[model samples]
Target: MTDRSDAHTATTPLAGRRVLVTGGTTGIGRAIAVLLASEGAKVFVCGRDAQHLDDALARIREVGEGDGITIDLAEEENVARLFEAATGYLGGLDIAVVNAARGAEGLTDMSEADLRYTIGSNFTAYLLSAQHAAKAMGAHGENATGQGDIVLIGSMSAYVLGKESTVYAGIKYGIQGFAIALRRELGKKGVRVSLVEPGLTGSDMVEGTSEEQAERIDKEEMLRAEDIAVGVHYLLTQPRRAVVQQVTISPRMQDEE
Candidate 1:
């Protein structure tokens, strides 16, 4: 039996790993950045908002030294620039956490403009980031341990039924498909791709919910940002011989209806 306790002891299983996290300035992405840095990975994070990016960079620096960049992932050129920045700052990449996404409100009332922006930010951005991350990690070759890992943050909403979630679910489902296909393609190259799905976590995304509705959802019972961070750490820390292809985490009290 594998000892999970030893796996997360403070000795830093990620000591020398070079990592990049998209949407790393807030919410789940920010939590992930902090956790990865605590484990000693040299972490680079990016976001589109300059003020938030600066704040996140300052907080992350308090934890450890890592680079942060401001880029709109929906733009191909910006995506390319992000990769270049990470390469220059970190020298190379070993792990990538794709955690950026936007929540669209009111599907029935949403404009086409809203739909386009939502998909572009949530779905296209993830694909673009992954493409660049794969290229960067591929260039680095496998580490001495012969493993490269990518963790894509997905949503339980992809599979759950919800009002006004048409675009969000669609994009998340697309990410699931992308992860499976990417894993198949990269497996041979020693790059393991996986998805992390968390249910109704408390974050900026949930602020849109009404107090009554949010309480009924039992947000307290739902997974926290750091909870998902622990999952990310677990997925990346596995021995080279093993791969956790997908992880679905929900509140123990969460019931599917």
Candidate 2:
């Protein structure tokens, strides 16, 4: 694949922006974080694993300014602290990408622990972080460059049925609803809320499949992480007057609903 760093820098509008991405150590969040950093955005990312956080930061630092913290979003304290730390590092907040989610092991027969963890990580985390984002951006003063942007990473499963993935789908469905409601409230403050729902993408989430299945998805069956990043960038960079409520992206080979 061709390197997108230089091309993205020369072409798009994310330079000098301060961004925070949750669950950004891998998968779609990683792609968005790295791409934004390469385009001159000071980014901060967080994940559950310290080792993965280190690895991601190394890659991000090679491209542009960035930092990472190991946070279990399910924990209330961590969720509260994340935005404050990220904003402190970036000096302020211009963009927040809500992309962290943990799947429950099978929809049926889930234990209480599985349900709590999944709900905390996938659903509640986004809401609490966005709340902090609103406060941070509001502090940007009267002449602030728009209040900022909140981009939620949803899933195509919100609209399409994925066998045995109903619990995950339900969380995404709630996210879509939350994103809509958020837009209604935040737009008055000059903050735009947008949702990017991605179809099957080649990431750790998709890695559970067989190798041949993964190859097919990478080559012809599904979208790539960078593709979803493109959608997120568009949402953040669009004219302040225009509010892009949501964008759904999928591989060309994936049949439409």
Error of 1 at 28 (Å): 0.7
lDDT of 2 by residue, 187-243 (tens): 877898999999878877765565765677767777778889888877777777788
Q: Which run of 10 residues does model 1 get worst, by summed lDDT?
A: 138-147
Clashing pairs in 2: none
Among all windows of 10 consecutive residues in model 2, the one with the lowest summed lDDT is: 138-147
lDDT of 1: 0.82
Model 1 collision count:
0
Maximum-lDDT candidate: 2
